[model samples]
Target: MKSSTRSLGARNAVLAVVLAIAGLAAQPAAAEERAKDLFGAEKLPTATAPQSFGFYSKGCFAGGVAIPMDGPTWQVMRPSRNRRWGHPAMIATIEQLSRDAAADGWPGLLIGDIAQPRGGPMLTGHASHQIGLDADIWLTPMPDRTMTRAQRETMSATLMVDEKTHLVKDALWTPRHTALLKRAASYPQVERILVNPGIKKKLCDTVKGDRTWLRKIRPFWGHDYHFHMRIGCQPGSPTCKAQEATPDDDGCGKPLAWWFTQEPWRPNKNPDAPKARDVMTMANLPKECRAVLDAPGPASAEAATYHGGAVPVAVAAPEPEAPSLPATTASGTAGLPSAVNAFTATPEVGVPVPRPRPPAK
Candidate 1:
């Protein structure tokens, strides 16, 4: 009886250990998977009417069009990022920017992430761009030669700001960059342009006259490498929300000076100074987005779908690898729309966390 009791006790202990292991593993899949994590799992854009819904950070897009990989004057960067999708108006704006840049005697534009197809909170990289109305133009000029797929993946954007002085670096700064920015700002459709305060200062100090476009280029954090361009809402989409108008003045005075001071960059005194952006769920978004998220699409779609009788090609610079896995904290906390299942199924590994994208400046 004693021997039988010992054997039974050991069996029960083994069973308990197995159950504990199972429970521990299960926690990552369910508890850690938030709604934002699901955005990447959606391989296709919402196939309903073409519309952008909710504000920039909490919305989704339907019938998104892909900006093609190579345009006459623009080429995309980071093909594996799968962020080339945008509203058609936004795409057209980029196309125009490319043409304008060339006309200004500047190299072609090296475009960065615009929005994911079926944009919602992204797995990484942005708080906005959720509704497909924003884009990033690399400060680095597109090379005169056609970029190889591998070169596009590996090349780094030029940093324009100097670290010690918090000002523009002379070596990397140029008048043509100012010309490109002025061109982007001149577009009436543009709501704003976000750049490092240093870049804004350079513009304010250097541009000879006609400061009108300066109002559109507002100062923001961490955009020394690229300028973020946001346009007004798509013309007919009432669901789309327009950001507040840029203030009346050119914003080159006190407002611009404030960014270079200690206040903006001062370390948060709050012991818990870093707070996450408001957690977004489908519940927090427009009701129409529910159908957008669940909508079906063409199997061959590359973030583009058949909409309004045209199949816009989803353009990406060739990628050496597949899209990355959902980013996780050191403690294994995952950012969401469907962090769990997507992470589980992702073929790629060790995806770098994208730099934290600040909300609109």
Candidate 2:
């Protein structure tokens, strides 16, 4: 009986050890699988990874540290060839700016024309900029380049200037380009704005690092031509990690001294000018400008600020209908015959002159 009891006890201990080993082995596999699901393993074939990769942990747009995507296990799926769409919050902000521009008769902002879209897995391991909210606006002057005249006019009107200077033109410091920069500074979703050398100088001088408003703007490489705008990660994304509010020298993954100048341009006398010449925020905006964007196409006089003396066209009233006679009255009048006066009576108009249908082909 003692020998049998010993054998049973030893068998139970062996089984317990085997179960513990199995549990330990299963843990890592489960963790790795979860990581793979979070970050896709492979690069998306057609998509490029995001550029100017930096992150923040606190502040407006970015909530905090982003969970990393595991490239080793997470496989990327090919995205469709449909039109590129941006994050809803980012789009909403851009649209507000555009509407404001149109209302002020400043034309529209050329966002996508020269803007860089965030890349995705198809290209390779996705980088920090992969989230759709980021964009890069070129800092170069608005020369003829390849853009159409209308495009140049539109971009320039929104404080984006492109001139052909012997020296490399910096967009951020130019007085003409201040509107967009200032407006961007006002948006809460923007965590950091990386610009070329000249742009940093301009921003520092313009706002004087009392950077109270410019707190989110940071300096980085690519000074020769374009300025990078980093959009904060939207809610629910795992990869977002916000960096410290102040700038740091950590691996921002940037080029060295690529920009040309450290000097700032002279400050414009009108640093405090409203976003557009005409419209302020809806509350302060002139009543006439408020109605301009809704008027379909551009406004005539009140809408077009360029025309010096043009007055706002009064909102046109709906045309009145020709007086319709009751059937009884019509019969009586016809029977009387003499009731009509040839000289004083008007001819029956078939249809109210169709307001000329505003000229068409």
Could you tell me the lDDT of residue 64 within candidate 2? Answer: 9
lDDT of each: 0.73, 0.33
Query: What are the clashing pairs of model 1?
Result: 35-337, 36-336, 36-337, 37-336, 37-337, 37-338, 38-337, 38-338
Q: How far is candidate 2 from the true structure (C-alpha RMSD, Å)?
A: 24.3
The TM-scores, one per candidate, come to 0.74, 0.36
In model 2, the runs with Cα more than 4 Å from the true position are 1-83, 101-106, 112-128, 139-173, 208-211, 247-361
TM-score, cand. 2 vs. native = 0.36
lDDT of 2: 0.33
Per residue, candidate 2 scores C-alpha lDDT tens digits across 154-260 of 44322322322213244334554555555665556665666544455455555543345555556553333444555555433333444444443321223223333
How far in Å is the alpha carbon of 255 misplaced in model 1?
1.2
lDDT of 1: 0.73
Task: List runs of model 1 lying over 4 Å from the truth.
Answer: 1-33, 270-278, 302-361
